[model samples]
Target: MSIRAARERGRRETFARLERKYRAGEYEEVEAEARALAAASRRHSRRRRPLPQWQARVLATGVAVAHGRGTEVLPELEALIDELEPVDPEAHVLRLIVRNNRVTVLNGQERYEDAETEALGILRDVTRLAHLTPLWRMELSALGALAVALCGQDRHEEAEAIARGNLPRAAEPALAGLHAVLVRSLNGQGRHEEALAEARRDPPHQDRRDSGLLDLVTAEALHGLGRRGEAEAAVRRALADCERHLHPAHPRIREARTLLGRVTGEGPGD
Candidate 1:
């Protein structure tokens, strides 16, 4: 098999094993395996004939994200991008993917401005592409990131506009995340009634993290509308759902806790 194919096979096998471990409730083992795979990939990349440079970096990035080391991988991804040949279309596509990953990392780190900047750059590059048919998925991904980053920055109106404009094209399962971004932007702007309405239109799948976020937005909107009883219940549900699915220190969990505190009149610190 070609180097790329071989690398792909390895990735698929590793992820399959990790998924099985996760399904079996072996989260600690899953995390350990993912971290080990990330380290192995990084070490392997130092070899003279390691998997293609971009492929190795992409593998490392995926592993970092899987292991909850998103922020830690940003510098490596950035350096990889700096070494790419910008004139090559393949390189350009890889750059977009890396930048999208960077946006994700920055967002997770709560660096909204940096995420917004990187996302905007990705969007601009997407526009410059002569043919977007092959890049449609990445384009939508960038747009989703841009919307989320805008919401993070409290530029809700702009975020809402972007999400609304792209919602139609986001019919695919992979693109459904745009809906969450839209709902979040609406909630951030204090459009409580509208946010609640949108959150219900096409609620996120129960198995997805977005579902927990949707609950959080619902809680926030209900609270803003002075429905304290409903808000408290919703916030508690959000907290429970997030705590069950996300890391203890994840930003989403922290936000849910803060919201619950507000709804319960206990303050976030308490």
Candidate 2:
């Protein structure tokens, strides 16, 4: 192989390994590993090798997010996105990824209008670049982010329409997020029965992250239906699952706690 091809292969392999570790919930480990890689890449850039720095930055940003650093990373990601011009296919794809990351962080920070606007822009680009088959997954991810943003803003009907239209086509990795949006949006619209029915249609999720999210929405639907005891039970389970599986600072953990308070009527809001 050419020298450039060999270097690219090595980088791709390293990134794939990091991706696997991140998915397995080894957040601290991934952070350390990615940081080390980023440092090395920076050194290479100084020597005129100019390795792709965005990959490391994206991984590190993901780690920060797991630790509930949405507010911290928001501006950094924006700056990085600005630095990345769509001058070529590689740069274009990297910019899209960073933009999507920004949208996700905005949603986590409860800046729903901004997230919605960013996601809409991302969707426009993804559609315009539809010839890139690999971008299909990014398109789904952006759509999911947009749906969540809409739900956050209480635009339930629009969110529900987006979820329902996309859920059937979502890949396995994107299923839980889109499903959560759908359930939450239904509950927002006061369609508790329909929301509960839809929640039940999902097979039991083995991953705690997925289960915890579904549990939260189920609790909301149950609470709306005046099933107080059941709602409390579901919310408590959701809180436990989130506490066990998510980062201490994860927005979902806070969300579960808030819902718990509402269900019990003994915590902060109540």
Candidate 3:
């Protein structure tokens, strides 16, 4: 095979390994590996040439955000967005994905209005790419983030409307996340019964990660309804699922623990 073909094969293999490590909740290791890959790829290319492998750099940025370094990574994400701007057909979708990550980071930082604005733009951009089936995931993700931003701003009713309106179109993998948002929106409105009912209406979850979130939300709804025993059970299930599927320090685990404390009249530190 030609040198170019061999290099492409090696790049794909490296990316596959990085993705697996990222998914396994090894963020620190994945971040280090991705950064090393990006630096090496850039050095291998001529000084004025674009890095032969952009995905590694993007992955590193994402891993940084995952590490709760959102403030630190925002500038990097912006630079990546500029670098990834449509030099190729695939680059546009990747650019939008990076933008989505920025919105997520802003939301994580509680910058609701900023996240809302970013998510709206992403929605418009992704809608224009609807012809590409794979790109539809970006649209769903942006919608989810928009709902979250609205919730953050205490606009729960609007969040509920958006989530309910999009439920039918949310692919199976995204259904549980949207449903979790819908439940939180309902709980925010003090509609505990509705929230509990909504949680029960969830389609079967294929991934434990998704079900764990629903469990946490279901506990909240139950707590709001004065079902302390049920709430404790749900929160315990959520804690177990999250502990197994998520990073040790993931926010979901902390949220579940806090709710458990509420249910049992014990402090979160316990």
Number of the top-ranking candidate, with lDDT as the measure: 2
Runs with alpha carbons beyond 4 Å of true place in candidate 3? 13-32, 47-52, 63-75, 86-88, 129-134, 202-211, 240-249, 264-270
As a TM-score, model 1 comes out at: 0.76
TM for every model, in the order presented, reads: 0.76, 0.91, 0.79
Q: What residue pairs clash in candidate 1, if any at all?
A: none
Tens digit per residue, CA lDDT, model 2, 1-270:
999899989999989998888777777788788888877888777543233676788788767665566677778888878777686667778789888888888888899999999999999988877775468788988999999999998899999999989988987657888888899999999999999999899543444335478889999999899898999999999888877776676788888888888888877753
Q: Write the per-residue lDDT of candidate 3 for residues 90-180, one digit (tens) a residue.
A: 7777788789889877876778999999999988777777776457767888898899899999999999998999988887556767888
Question: Which of the two candidates, 1 or 3, achieves a greater TM-score against the reference?
Answer: 3
Candidate 3, backbone clash total: 0
Residue 149 error, candidate 3, Å: 1.1
Q: The CA-based lDDT of model 1 is what?
A: 0.72
For candidate 1, lDDT tens digit of each residue in 42-94?
Answer: 66776643334455456446445533457666788788677666676767776
* Cα distance off (Å), candidate 1, residue 139: 1.4
Worst 10 contiguous positions by lDDT, candidate 2: 202-211
**lDDT of each prediction vs. the true structure?**
0.72, 0.82, 0.80
Arranged by lDDT, best first: 2, 3, 1
Which candidate do you rate higher for lDDT, 1 or 2? 2
Evaluate residue 47 in candidate 2 and report its C-alpha lDDT on the 0 to 100 scale: 43
